[model samples]
Target: MALAETILRAVHKHDLVPKLTRALPWISLLFSFASVIWLLMLPIDGNYRKSYISENALMPGQVTSYFRESEWNIVRGYRNELKIFEGAAIDERNAVVEGWLKDIGLKTAYHRLHDPSVQDNMYAILHAARGDDTEAMVLSVPWTTSDGEYNLGGASLAVALARYFNRMSIWSKNIIIVFSEDGHKSLRSWVEAYHTSLDTTAGSIEAAIVLEYGGDSDYFEYYEMHYEGLNGQLPNLDLLNTANLVSYHENIHISIQQTEGEKLTRNDYLTRLKTFLKGIVSLTLAGIVTPSNGCESFSGWQIQAFTIKVKGTSGGNDITQIGRVVDETFRSVNNLLEKFHQSFFFYLMLGPRYFVSIGTYLPSAALIAASFALSSLSCMLNSGFTIPHFLLNISSVLKFFVMIELSSFLLSTFLPYLVKQTTDESDKISLVNLILLSMTSLVNINSKFAFSMISFSLFFIAMVIVALLILNFSLALCIGLLAMPLQFVQQLLNSIEAKIKVFLCLFVSNPFFVVYITGGLYLEAFGYQNGTLNLMTGLLTSWDDVQCWTWFIVMLGWFPAWLSIAISCGLGDFKNQAPVSYIKKNQ
Candidate 1:
């Protein structure tokens, strides 16, 4: 009780007002200090230099490999066959590929993945190894067409890889090569089905490696890999480290490009690229070998998959080289006696090289979000009612909750119908009439302007959402959260016609706006949820993307200008501040 009293006294003694010689709260300073240190330190997490061997057991690029000449011949033959059978349905392609796999001595099983979310068929498999069928690996190739035309050569490569893999006895894990008919959605579904298969006792699979855009028979032009998975999930970091080792050994330009990079820095880029490939391989193994936890199938979760964007003016490594790289990567993964569990998954990559953990960055966003809730609650608390002779404080703060619930219900039930009617050209509704109707629908029975404020706020909120989708999700989340306080503050100022409202807004809005725009962006980019305030946490703990910081400054200055104008109109002059005088002369 004594400690509590002392704390309360300290809080009461320290005022936030200017010109007061008292100490402000230490919490804010602590937060700001932490944010700055984190932002600066994140840039120098330092990427792999020469990709030193993290694991000594696996020796890469040391063995005498001979897939180059023979793989090319097979690739050419498959290409010729595919060219002849072009324009075939996915089923026809799958059938031909299955025949090729069987002929190559690989055990093949096809799964007909039906996705109700978007109707599509995704074919997958379990390729048991020659000796023991204990562990396995996956390789996936999605069909990309040249002018909405399917690239038939992709099937040929999958079949060829299966054949090549079947011939090799060095593989400690069995292989599962999948040919996805649909693109991203289908890949997600196939992974989900594979994970679901583990629930029964029939689980017999291991890691995964997705092959995309592998048609170039010439030098392999592999781009950087994207590793952030669904809801910020990631494959184990050891897989990433092992991949880095392989990239160095193979003398390839591997890069790790995150959402944070504008251009690829060679070393960081290469490490990330190698890491991305390894992630595919490791995730494939995880799906097959680890039961039930590979990919979230029922919940529509997806793996962190990427493609090899082979681009080069001069002809580089051939399909054989790529096959070797894939083979070596699989061999490395097969060397793993356990599932990947040593690396961090929930992390924000400030750059390909740098990252901040979730624990470090979550609080910043939570704090900013809490500010909104606090301000709203404060307004409700202070909105005292007035009677004829006394100030009647009826604490009906719960009314807002009830109103929000009702609004959500109405919007959910009627929004689709309204949208349909709004889009109807035959309805012939005038713009003015539409506006009036929208306004009317928003007006509450008692508090006309109060509800109007909410309605307008929500409408703009939705518009902002649409605009965000059109722009960038991270950008949208920042703008929306930042604008929320301004919208609320604007309404409050308008309600009271308070002269100091502008000053209050400038003081409060500027800082929070910066926090909102800048903070929200980092959070969203780092795969934080779509919360207006959650982004703040990301900003404090994550490396501030310098590009976003520019826009953040612009947003920061916006509210201050309006605030200045409002102040000028309300209290900038003596006349504005003069007390109102009423004179009545009567006989």
Candidate 2:
């Protein structure tokens, strides 16, 4: 008791950390700069490690593959057969595919989802000849991509593989071949149904591979392997590593999202930087907004999945090599003693061969979040470190936060449905931009409320980013970078130029605007048609079908927190410091 009294008296008599408190802003700036520099360092050779196989039981590319010229005619035959049903009804196409599966002497099944989409699922089971049916693998081929491109090459290859698997007897787990109507949506529904609703299941699924080439006989340049799963989830690194090594073994080039320059070249600084940025963007938006690649449907089921698509036309490699890659890859996974384990589940790939581990890249996001936390604490200290800040006008502050949040909530609830009412591609984004722009209100603020809300909101952002860092590092870092200036916005409101700077920050940081700009850049990066409506469509479907909370957080949490801070800072009266000084003295 005597010791505690002495410390309290010392604290009350003298302010020991005033200098430290004043240095918080500079410290935060330095930390932010250092964090950004750390991320930029990833493109350097030493900052990343070459990816390797983690599971020794599964040795990739060790076995000789017999999937060469023998199966070429069969694949072409199926590809030719699919041309008749190019624009046919869903049932018609499914019937044709199911007929081919039945002809291959396999147990075929018909699954029709009772939805208005009128889409159906066609699958066949190739029971393992040498082992009991205790575990299984999936070879899923979506009839058409979510963007509405029919996957003729992929389906033909899948059918050819089904026929080839029936001829071999080295299989351990049963192989289930699936052809879904919709690339992602119907595949997800069918996978869910296969586990929970269907009476016929091959047993627990161990792994899945999705084929997504659009042309059957054409020579391709490189393989684009997509590993991101729903909700920003990633497959075990071993699975990706297996496929990557096997592709190299077959003399095939490979790449991932947004990293398409000179394929298989990671030596140049610009190549590495572009690869890092593109990969980060793709992984950051995984699940909720990023374009679906059909492999994500198998996530959350303890099943490792990836989509392999052959792109470009300049290369000499043909479907035969792709077949061998798939065949050897399957043989590798088939040797797994148990499910995938002992490999990284969270990692960033510089390319197929190189990767930056969670340890190397995670610190960048952690530092940014720490800066926010530090700024929040500094604001609290300025207000005399009150718990709930009783000096704040509780009634007014409550109304302010509630009002701003309610507006965001209302938009989140209805905007998706509202966009569906219009079919115009331009109008879809226009609606969002208009609604958010209208939601903007430039009004005066209470200094006490500004400080308190900034204190709370900054802390909230830091916590949110910390949580997101575990789930999606790119998202956490993106939000942190966007809101970096927010902590000090309140202090710089004294001048007109400062106010304009704040407005510019708010303008660029708007999530809707960010989506529009980034969405365009992503489309333009690849030769994809410019349409953000797909992103909106994906967000809506993910929210309704998969119950993704990313949309909700963006709506009710992210936007509201940002808008409240912007409103508080935009018109806040900082010239009069009397209120804060009075509260400090009295407290």
Candidate 3:
């Protein structure tokens, strides 16, 4: 409270409207930081809910399944056939597969898509059960890339499933078998084409089940379900629930991990970790190449993306069993009457079991980002009217904008070379270091520290005025932002401390230090014991009262924190300034 009074008085003494005026910068910084934190916290995990019939008429998982027995020999024969003709030319493979589908008495037609992004061919179709191909569910099996590789057993199983599906007359929805080329990238494009109104050239598709590898006899340690959809849009809550239910019902020992989850199997972990590193590498090289030549974004499918083949493992579950999982899953999706609308479009999962919704975690990252933006805005507002300094500030802002423009330009140029350099193992550190250096250079060059301080101070004052809002949000956010300046002060002193011992002593003694350390332990308790973190996740799934209130507070609180900080710093000279000193001197 004393600190608040001191800050207000300092702002008031300045020629600028003091008092709460100082709080403006602080508030702005807080809001900007919160926004950035929100973006970063967006969930990227692949766990999707199972699709269910939203409309009353659509009954899913209801049909008496004929797939229980008597089909083991046929499934094995199909699996064996897959090994012999694997990765053969798509046309040759298609001919044989089409013959099999026709023999099973299903009407099939080929849908071709030409993807210009990676230059590949994709083959897909609708398997009409009775006659009319009105509503359809997609069963996608990516064909081999240009290279002759027989690794994607998931695609082979999908093909066999298509043949099996053709024989069944019970399917109410038409099953479209899509043989996507160029891997996941091409599949994304084709699926986009199918759904988009502007790009409706690919025709309409209902729900889609992407089959990755499922042909080998060797069992996987556990069935891995990849659900992180493009851009964080999940399938449906019911879909995820159904998959979990079905996985259990089948008595198949399986553990699921979304693409970014924590409890990942060793192989899954290594595979994704490698992909992340490679992505970073590609981006770094892309940055360098963009300035000199035109470039394109690199594909993980083309690089060290994880490839789990069915032929390698011998223990978990058989090819036939995997086929049934996909079949049952599709049957569940076939029941969907409406598009996915309930679940969150964006989320981050720590593991398959642990997840954070966009709402809760978003604030953490968004707060960070909002802090930057608030600092920038406060910087702009406090920009000294002094002619030379104002001009200097303007020049700096312009220069930073120019750098951003140049980076964008570079990104468009020399993309291929950047991708190659990234994929090359030998060039790792050089690329990573360069990227970091560039980003840091850009951020530092653009930082308006003096103005930012003034902004932070002003925002802090404003927050005090509205103390009533303190209880509206998770206290964690309020405390975090309020302590930012203290954190800054401690860091600054720590940097200049004379000795290691002195620095450690000052750190422990600092006012902010005790709060942070104590708060951290308490936060851990909330996360582990109370389901506090998961409660946030649940809130994010639906637009409930808590999420609405949380968003409001985060948005409102951020700016004030930044503005107050800035204002506080701008008034730093107030302690020595005297009012009406000229009159006193004359007397």
Tens digits of lDDT, candidate 3, 61-111? 454445534555665566677677765766666677677666765555544
* Per-model TM-score on C-alpha atoms: 0.59, 0.88, 0.53
Model 2: per-residue Cα lDDT over 420-473, one tens digit each: 565555576677778756655445566666777776677778888889987878
Ranking by lDDT: 2, 1, 3
* Whole-structure CA lDDT of model 3: 0.42
lDDT per residue for candidate 1 within 464-555, as digits (tens), equals: 33443322322333443444434344234434455466456444545445655533564345343553344333222121111122122222
Error of 3 at 352 (Å): 4.6
Best-fitting candidate, measured by lDDT?
2
Higher lDDT: candidate 1 or 3?
Answer: 1
